[model samples]
Target chain A: EAGVAQSPRYKIIEKRQSVAFWCNPISGHATLYWYQQILGQGPKLLIQFQNNGVVDDSQLPKDRFSAERLKGVDSTLKIQPAKLEDSAVYLCASSPRGGGGNEQFFGPGTRLTVL
Target chain B: DQQVKQNSPSLSVQEGRISILNCDYTNSMFDYFLWYKKYPAEGPTFLISISSIKDKNEDGRFTVFLNKSAKHLSLHIVPSQPGDSAVYFCAARGFSGNTGKLIFGQGTTLQVKP
Candidate 1:
């Protein structure tokens, strides 16, 4: 079975420039997530989607970051006015369900370097 | 607050030796724990998992032991192979007013020398 897929394994952008990342989940997966991993730190959950509907996004900086899942299969995460602090890897993951004990399958991730 | 913590940033062991990685979590509500292995430039792969009710779970040469009283867990690899060299991350699943999100540690890079 194919795993989660992401586009543009690496990206470099200037400060204040906008960037977007794409993700395609595994077949029949109902839950999708976007996470940010800074240097030397664990991946932080930014947003979660369950079948095209939002489940949680409390940690997301709505002022600069946004995400959406269309048709419950593919999702996109966007950052506006990117800052130097946004120079980190943006990871996408999907799961069969959005409940406990369900393992999340991750993608290769998009490394965004904001100069 | 960092709920999950992996104190060791890295570890090195001989190919035939045993490797033990430790993790501690501050949240008592975390009911499930998991370990993921990751190579540079690749996504993390699920290694092993154990529920809170179980103290130990083993698969092949990997074993995960959880101590609820101490809120600590560990991953053990025996007769480690060179291919086992990778970053190991400890994650915990529990409801924190949000969906069941997994809190992860800083990750520990392991090097299994030939």
Candidate 2:
């Protein structure tokens, strides 16, 4: 089976510039998630989508970050006026469904470097 | 506030020896816990998991023990291999008004020497 797919494995942008990351989850997966992993730290959940509907995004910085899963299959996370601290790897994951113990399969992630 | 924490930033063990990584969580609502292994430049991969209903769960050479009273959990790898060198993260899932979301620990880097 194919795994979760993400684009632009690496990215670099100047501070205050806008950047976007794309993700295409595994086929038939009902739940998708976006996470940020700063260097030397674990992945932190940024947002979750269950079939195109947001399940949770409390940890997301509403002022600068936004994400959307259109058609429940492809997702995009965007950051505007990026800060230096936003330099981190952005990961996308998918599971069979939501509200269970199912394991999530992660993509290689997009490493964003804000200069 | 950091809900989950892996205090040990790093650990080194010789090949064929045992490796133990510890993690602590402060949230009492966490009902399910999981361990994930990650290599440099790669996303984390699910290693093992345990539910609150059980105190211990073992799979092959890996075992996870949970102490509810102390809010601690551990991962044990027996006869460790050099290939096992990677960062290990502990994650917890609970009803924080969101059923499937997970909170992750900072992570512990384990280096197994040959």
Q: Where does model 2 exceed 4 Å of error? A: A100-102
lDDT of 2 by residue, A1-115 (tens): 9999999899999999999999999999999999999987888989989999998888999999999999889999999989999999999999998763537999999999999
Which tens-of-lDDT digit does each residue in B5-104 have in candidate 1?
A: 9999999999999999999999998989999998999988899999999999999999999999999999999989999999999999978576799889
lDDT (10s digit) by residue, model 2, range B13-106:
9999999999999988888999999998788899999998899999999999999999999999998999999999999986756566788999
By summed lDDT, which 10 consecutive residues of candidate 1 chain A come out lowest? Answer: A94-103
Spell out the clash pairs found in candidate 1: none
Docking class of 2: medium
The DockQ scores of all candidates, in the order shown, are: 0.68, 0.67
For model 1, residues A1-115, the per-residue Cα lDDT tens digits are 9999999899999999999999999999999989898978888899999999998898999999989998888999999989999999899999999964547999999999999
- Candidate 1 CAPRI-style tier: medium
